[model samples]
Target: MRIGLLTEGGYPYATGESALWCDRLVRGLAPHTFDVYALTGDAGQEPAGRLPLPPHVRAVRTAAPGDAEGGGPGGRSDRCGYGRRERGRFEAAFADLAYGVCAGDVDTGAGPHADPAERFAAGLYALAELARAHGGLPAALRSETAVRVLESACRASGARRTLAAATLPDQLAVVEQWERLLRPLSLDWYDASDGLGRVDLCHAASAGAAALPGLVAKRFFGTPLLVTEHGSRLRAHYLATAGAPFTTPVRALLAAFHGRLAGEAYRRADLLTPGNAHTRRWQERCGADPDRLRTVHPGMDAERFAETGEHEDSGDPATLAWIGRVEPAKDLVALLHAFAAIRRRQPDVRLRIIAAPVRDADAAGYLALCRSLAAQLFPAEAAGAHAAGESPVSFEELGSPEAPTLEDAYAAGAVVVLSSVAEGFPVGLVEAMFCARATVSTDVGAVVEVVGGTGLVVPPRNPTALADACLALLRDPGRRHRLGAAARARALELFTVEQNLAAYRGLYLELLSHAPVRHRAAPGVPFAHPAESHVPGSWADRPAAPATSAPVKATATTVAAAPGDPDA
Candidate 1:
């Protein structure tokens, strides 16, 4: 089946979260054709170049967030150029949607035109079509014409009083926000010639920005969309403070719009795949049908750390290793306090906080704070400690020559520790398990779920609890060995790329079976195209043949299992 693989700043790009997983999925499922529609965060990431494309990926198209319409904050006031009829329709549609957001009522009156949710969807499509027909909506929405239309809608009954009373600055800000929010509508990706309109299904790698294009594609064409959220996009955006600088009213309004869009996407999708039960719960709360949701954990590459478990820990096994990006969210402060408690119990115990250098500003600041806390925790220096190279707690970067690589870092200790106060998948925990290291993780994000019964899970922000869990593994060598072995086994079975590929291979077929195809070869192509172009036109009409004698490498089906027909 042809799949429209939608992503934002990832998969195809060397940088970007979830790039590795997306690459694995594409390469693993070579039988299904993938057309990639990637939205880049900036022009700098473009220089990183693209990842090696597998045979499954038929094509890739990219655009950037920085290229969104209205290059300047002041350019939105020009609207004299739009014709009267088109301007009126555009303004009216936008105003109706905006009113729905301002009033916080999806069902304005339950009618097609008045229903707020329907109005928003219809208006979003109208704006997209308008942009397609014209050059784009950058200048149009920024225009005074758009503002006047919004003003009229706000004054109409059933609209919120605050919207009607919005100051000039508020009006301008709202218009600018709308332009940014609707930027996906202006992208040139909704035509039949492009792979988007021809794909059997659109599989969005994430929700929010990455999924925006999928929504647009569905609206433009009758394409069925499948949105998969590993980390909740809405939650992540809220946590990351994407547009926090805006006024509360503006933020709330935009939030409502995103919520509505998410709801609509969930409502229309044939299926929703969330990476964990935590994320799935969020989807359900946001109106996703319980029946349509599936939990699929993101696969991890486990082969690299296989050598670390070759020997059991015996040499000065007092080291506690913490591996992950050094961010405030990881709660290094609490970790330091926990380490101090461990030191009080076992004076010889050592703690190593291995963090990657901060690439982002927030993380840089957080790392500095963690370093300061470590200094404060281990303030007293022994007279001969400098020569002996001994410190109770140490902050080290991942690539330091002393440890060299991540595998070496993990092998430094028998126990891996995760002190994150906010987490999604706990990649660090999985990496530790791959190295056959027992883990003690704070209860956050998917930590408990990922660890399952293999490791000790403690409550977040409790230094005593965290310290005790670490001590349990530290004191009992036998327990550590057993837990480490079990953890490794679990990760190898469920989290490895091989298992992930197998799950997705089955899901691909399952989705194809239920989601009718929308594409077909031209008149001159090999087989008869199904009326529903997404279906295999010839496969539908053919009688079942005896098993095939040759293996189909793409499907991983063995030849010996089937006998007779060439194309079974």
Candidate 2:
């Protein structure tokens, strides 16, 4: 099967949220071909180039969010050059879309037979079709006319009160953002011969703009779409726009747009796969059908940590280790306080913080703050003996002679600690499990689900609870040993690369079996029939039995059945 893998700021890129997992999936499923459609987030991401792609990847097409600004080679003219009829159609459709956004509830009742969701969907697709027909969306989408239309919609009756206070600047900001988010409508990737229509299944790595093309493919052609969300796109958008510089009305309008998009994507997808239960619940709240939702955990390589898992007894019993990118959401401050508490009880205990380098300047500032806090919490023991009895807290990075790799960092301590207040999948905790190290993680995101009773769980931002949990395992070697053993087993069973590949392989075939097959034959072909098996023996001439009651419907059982079965 050929898969169209759609992503934003990830996969093929050297850095991004879902880059590693997407790379692994493409590499693991070698029998299937992949065509990647990536929407890049920034200019810095392009300089790193892409990860080496496997042979199964047939093509990589990328577009940046800024591509809609009308300054590039394919950018449209500033005047729009719309005919009178086309201008009227554009005005009508844009008004409906903007009004739906300002109203705050895209599916709410405008009337008894209104169907607001259908209105939103109709307006969006109408604009997409218009853009396709005209070669691209007019630069008018980013013009003052667009902002004026948006302002009018905000002032319409039944609009939210928050939208009533929107000024010209706020309207302009919203229109600019909308242009970027709707850029997919101007792309030429919907053709049946060479674009998304050629794939058997369109798999969107996340929602919002990345899934926009997949949605278009399903709408223009009869392609099946599968959307996977490791982190809820709606939730991320809300968090990012919460305290942004935009006005309240602008924020509300942007939120409503993303919410409506997510709802539409959920409604149209043949299947929804969330990386964990935390993400699954978010999707459910956004109106995803429970029957279509499936939870698939991200995979990690267990073989890389095999040596550390086998020798769990080698780490220092009095040391606690924390490994991950240095960011404020990780709550490194809380971890330092918890460590101080642990030190008061056990003075000889040490903490090693192994941080991964990040591209964001804010994260670097956070790392510096963490270092200052560590120094303040643990004062140097006599200035001259800084090396002799150095502060028990030490910050290190990977690739140093002391800790060369992630596995080496996990091996430096008997218990791994995670104090993140906000998280997605707690990948670092899972990596600890892969190394057979007992963990003490705060209860956030999917940490509890991933741990599965194999390690200690404490509430977020509670220093006392975190310290106590770490102390409990530190004081009892037998309990730690048992937990570590169980964690290794669980990680190997459910969180390995092999299990992840099998789940997706099955899902791909299941979706394809139900989808209508596209005929790619030439126009002159008699029946437009694809090649079928032809046996050149006596059995080929035998008449087939024709009295079967009816064909059996395919179920999950039949779809997953082994080959060579009569029913198969």
Candidate 3:
């Protein structure tokens, strides 16, 4: 089976969150071919410096978020502006989206007839058609004409109560943000030249902006889309919109837009795979059918932490180790308060905060705040020579002689502590599990789901609960050993690249089996194994059914004969 691995700011890019896992998955599934459709976020992720790919990857095509701004040359397939019929469809669909959002009629929940899903799908396809005719959607979605169209739609009958209450400015502000975010749908990536229309399945690494093109491919080419979200896209959007400088009404309107898009993705995708149950519930709430949803945990490199489990353990017996990017979300303030309690109960206890390598300026600020808090917490203890030498709490970067690697960081403590008030998946907890170390994590995001009773779960921002959990693990080495063993067992069983590949391999064949082969050759061309298959390691070496010829017109555009097409 051929798989179109769709990603945004990841995969082929050497510097994104999902790059390593995606590379591992593609490499593991040698039986299938992959074509990477990467939507990068910046120039730094240019394909020229992409990760080394395995032979199974046939091609790598990329378009950045920046591409939607029309910053470079005009798109290759641009036609003139839309004609009357297409323009009508675009106007109608755009109005439906605006009115649905404005009126609170956008249902981001499961129901037999959800208008948000319909609105998003209709608007998306309409935009796609418009982009195919015009250069792209930039001029159309943001134009004065577009805003006026939306207002007209809001006043139309069947519009929601919110629309009736909304002013013209509220409507325009919402439309502007929606247009900017939905730009991915207008790209030419789904055309015949791109492999998107041809693949047996389209697997998006995450939801949100990255998954937009996959939704388009599914709509335009009838591609079987499989959307996987490790972090809940809707939740992230809500958080971002809340903090954004936009007005409350604008945020509400954009939130409605995001909620609608997510619902559409869930409704349209053949299957939805969230990394954990926390995200799965979010998807379900956002209108994903329960039957089509599966929870597939993100795979990680277990081997990297194996050595830490075996040797060079965290030396302080009562020490609590925090490993991850030192961001405010990690809740270092809470960790410090908890550690203070631990210090008061047992003065010898130490706290080791492991900081991720800082390439981002924002991370530097977070680290500084953590350092000041740690100093204030232990001020008298570190007032004189101790401050200059060894402190009770210290911030350590990833690579140092004292804490050389991730393994070293894990081994340096008896308990791995995660105090983050906000989290997607506690990646640090998984790393600790790989190192065969016990963990104490605050209940947030997918923490309880990922840990799965393998560690101690405390309430978020509760220093007392956090301290008690760590102290329990510290005092009982036998309990610690048992938990560590179980954590490792769970990680190996469910969170390995091997397991991830197996799941997708099964899904690919399952989706294909439901659709009969629709790309058989012409009358005289035998459907037998081709000559290339006879080359030792190919399918000719394996047993096969006899050839029977019955031509089926390829309904999918990507079915056009490539170099190795069975029909050719």
Candidate 4:
């Protein structure tokens, strides 16, 4: 089967967990060919180039907003110069989006567009049709005309209080962002000859901008769409924009758009695979069909930690390890405070804050603050009598000689720790589990779900609970060993790349099985082409006779399967 994989700022173009998962997905599913439609989020990603791809990936088509993130705060816009009729069509369609955002909602409506979600979907597709018919919609979306329509909707009856409070500049800001989010509609990927339309299924990496194209493909060509997100996109947006400088009105408008888009995508998708129950709840709350949802945790490669798991008793009994990116969200400060409590209970116990490579611009500052706090909390001079100049707390990078590989990092600790206050899928926790190590993590995101009953989980941001949980495993070696063994078995059975591949491979075939089987060679069918069809030619009328006994010569009848045979 042919699969169209949709993504944003990940897969072949970037590194880290999201990209790694996408790469494995494409490579692991060797039976099905893939066509990747990637949307880059950063300018730097283009220069870095793509990761090595397997032969099964047939094509890679990419787009940046307007050549370079167009129509954003400081980016160029794709000008769609619409004449009179086109302008009217755009205005009418855009008005539905505005009304849906400002007023028409589940609670307030009684008409043809009673459901605000319906209004939102209608407007989104109408604009998409306009873009498809008239090239694109960047100029119109960023025009004074769009601003006027938004303002009028804000003042209309039944308009929400927050939206009505929006100022002119706020409207402009919202319009700028909307144009970027809707940029996928203007892409030429829906062509039947050699693009998304020809694929048997559309598999979106997430429900954000990546899934927009899938929605369009399903609408245009009846292709089945499957959206998977290890980290929920709506949750990320709410977290990022929480304390921004924008007023409530602008935030509300943007949020309304995001929510509606998410709901529409949820409603239209043939299946939705959220990474964990944490994410599944969010999708369910936003109106995803309960029957269509599945909780598929993103898998980790167990072989990466094979050596560490094999020698489970190698780590120092007194050491506790924390492994992940050194970002503010990880709450290293809280971890430091927890370690201070651990120190009071046992002076010889050590805490190692082993960070993965930092990516965010603010990570350096966060790491610096963590280092200073650790220094003040446990002065080296104070511990001179016991460990002889060792402060009992150490900071190291993953690639350092002491902890060179992933296995080395896991082997450095008797008890692995995760102190994140806001996590998504807990890749580090799963790594610890794969390495057969006992873990103590904060109760956030998918930590509870991923850890299951294998590891200890404490409430997030509570230093005392975190310290207590770590101390329990540190004091009892036998319990640690038992938990470690159980964790490894769970990881091997439930979270391997092999398991993920099996799940998705079945899902892809299942969707295709139910769909109307259209031949690639079927002429005059929409989105049908000769791309994957067998080359037509004349064949022998009858099967060749069997070779005579003792005759060693090659014959057509001796062949295992014939090329043009109907059964073959």
Clashes of each: 4, 0, 6, 1
Q: In lDDT terms, which candidate is top? A: 4
For each candidate in turn, give its C-alpha RMSD to the true structure in angstroms.
7.1, 7.0, 6.3, 8.0
lDDT of 1 at 227: 87
Candidate 1 deviant stretches above 4 angstroms: 66-74, 105-110, 113-115, 149-166, 310-316, 382-384, 517-519, 522-525, 531-568
The C-alpha TM-scores of every prediction are 0.87, 0.89, 0.86, 0.89
lDDT per residue (tens digit) for residues 1-568 in model 3: 7788988777887765578878888988887888888878676668458888888788888876557745343322222245777667667767656655555554555533356556556667767766765668765666665777777766776555455666877866776667667777667677644457767778888777777778877777677888988889889878877778875656666777777777788888888889888899899888889999888888888877776666424445677888888677888899899989989988888888888788878888878887888878888877852746877887888897777887788888888999989998777788888887889999998888778978999999899999999999988888988888888888888887778878877877777777434332233445433343433343332344345633223334323454454323
Q: Which residue pairs show backbone clashes in model 2?
A: none
Which wins on TM-score, candidate 1 or candidate 4? 4
lDDT of 4 by residue, 262-357 (tens): 888888999999989989999999889999998787877899799899888889999999888888889999999999999898988988788887
How far residue 319's Cα lies from its native spot in candidate 2, in Å, is 0.4
lDDT of each prediction vs. the true structure?
Answer: 0.75, 0.82, 0.75, 0.83
Ten contiguous residues minimizing lDDT sum, candidate 1: 558-567
- Tens-place lDDT per residue, model 2, 1-568, is 7799998888889775489999999999888889999888776777878999987798998887656435243433344457878777777777767876776553455453255556667778888888878766647586555777889988987788898898988887788778778888888788776788778899999878888899889999879999998888898899888878877878888898998899889989999999999999998987799999989888888999999999987799989999998888899999999989999998888888988866689988999899888878877532433868566888888767778998999999999999999888888888899899999999998888999999999999999999999999999999998999999999999898899889999999899889865534333334333322122334432233345533222223212222321111
List, residue by residue over 1-568, the lDDT tens digit for candidate 1.
Answer: 7788888778789874588888988888877778898887677777878888986577898877646554334555556346888887777667666656555463556566676666666777777777777657777877887777666665666765455556667667777777776777777777765547666678898767677777777776767778888888878767755647866555555676777777677777778988888898888987799998878887887768878855546324789988888777888899889999999888889888888866888888888787777776777743346567877777788889867898888998878899988988788888888888889999999888888899999999999999999999999999999988899888888788887788777777777677544333343334333443333336443333335533212222211212321112
Which residues of candidate 2, in runs, are more than 4 Å off? 66-80, 106-113, 380-389, 522-568
